[model samples]
Target: MVTKTEETQLDRLENQVDNGGGGAWEYLCLIRKLKVRRSEKVLKHGLSILNDPKKRSSLGSEEWTLYEQVAIAAMDCQSLDVSKDCIRVLQKRFPESKRVGRLEAMLLEAKGSWAEAEKAYSSLLEDNPLDQVVLKRKVAIAKAQGDISGAIDCLNKYLETFMADHDAWRDLAEIYVSLQMYKQAAFCYEELILSQPTVPLYHLAYADVLYTLGGLENLQAAKKYYASTIDLTEGKNTRALLGICLCSSAIGQLAKGRIKDDKESSELQPLAVAALEKDYKQRAPEKLSLLTTALKSLKVSS
Candidate 1:
């Protein structure tokens, strides 16, 4: 007697558990389940597979990888006993593996053994000074322990070695922004823009940082980057269009205070105003308030 809503929910859960049918897909399902905090479902599906004698014996080398994934998910779910059992299986299978050793350190961190986790990470680094995984894990531990500066330092050191790691650069930039270190975050975005100029996100991000760290020069640069964003997105980027208007206003105000006859602002301000007004009129009637405000701020009467 399941209601339609209940049946739909069950179907979705089944789809997530099935997750497109493969070992790799199963791993992804476990990770996806962990992301949504569906720990009980993860335990139910994962243990059903691992507990079957035939399946457990047949997993072969993949057993260790499965155990590690399940162990981490179990730890997150507070199923410490299940996690411990999975970790023991992994430890027994790969006694000398540094990869398993990192998992051990992760378990310690999960158990709230911060000092021991740090020690284990340090010991691993001593064994091989260039282990990127261990370095990242140590940084994560530092962040979890509220050592913001320590985490930043560790990330900087890691980036020195892995300069082209875009994910690491993005993480570092976010950390810097959280600390209000706009210049450093801007540098990270600059590198991203240099590597992938066609990425509109990087251009927009760099423009935002420059606008936040305002000066005449920075505002001008922000305007240029915002223009690039608009062009890259085929002029459909409302935010970038607004950014152009705002930067033009800021520059005009600065010029009014310093130079009585500012040639650049005079040249750019009319063009910016015309573009914004045209877009504002073409947009949906419901969305005109924001564009109106931007136009008013720039003193563009329309």
Candidate 2:
């Protein structure tokens, strides 16, 4: 269902078409093409409209917004020259706009000017300390430059304000994982689980972290979280099943210090192994040898 605002816009587009406003009709078609991710069409139509000095000038104040749109579409189409042309026009028109500053920073980054892009982003942040767009760009620039520590710091700062941003948490966790900082990654996954306990990916990630940081205690926690993942995904999670096998094997190895293994431990290992064997037979027969090797490495009999 089209919303009232979109209906109004469509009505205006129809009126433009009726009045022989070919430019408006073209612009509407360009927007629709963009909506459907037809980047080539956007570049083709946007360039044709932008190439006309009369139509471009006639747009007046609206021209800047059109320039920004065309600039982004051109960038998507790898037409950097056209994109830069649009950006240059916008820079001249909106010299003091922070939004324009961001576009300049993006253009700089796209041009492989890492240092200049970072500087531009920093300048933008200084001008408006709460600029989320600039902050995000700073994080991206840091990551692009292989400054993982700097990217993590920037994301942490962002999360201090936007604590509920799951994507930020996930990004930070992935960076930590890249650096082999499993404990730190686990902390991020913990936050995700605390806030969105029902998300299977968060549970699986947390479980994987705990398993990677393995001691008997951490493995036990990993087993429990992997169980949660399996439950959340209706037991169709192959990775969770494998995690259960590994965790159970590790726990069984640790059980020599105790009088006997716990009841869940006694029950879970057989079930996980059974499920894994069944899945291997049905979906991935070629991987059965690899699965057997992994199970053997964990001292679990297949």
Best by TM-score: 1
Assess each prediction's global lDDT (C-alpha) against the native: 0.78, 0.81
lDDT of 1 by residue, 1-302 (tens): 23346556555656756674435335435355444445566676678778887877787776666677778778778788898898888888779888888878888998899999989999999999999889888889889999999999999999999998776788888889899999999999998888778988789989999999999899989988988998788777777877887887887787665756357545655666666667877766666777677588576444
Segments in model 2 whose C-alpha atoms lie over 4 Å from true places: 1-79, 85-100, 257-259
**How large an RMSD does model 2 have?**
8.4
Task: Give each prediction's root-mean-square deviation over alpha carbons.
Answer: 7.2, 8.4
**Residue 215 lDDT, candidate 1, scale 0-100:** 94
Q: 1-302 in candidate 2: lDDT tens per residue?
A: 24446667666665665465655535445456434454565566566667888877776776666677778777777788888888888888778888877887788887879989988888887878888778888898889888889999989999999898887898899999999999999999999999888888889999999999988889999999999999988888999998998888877777765847678766888788888888898999999888888888887765
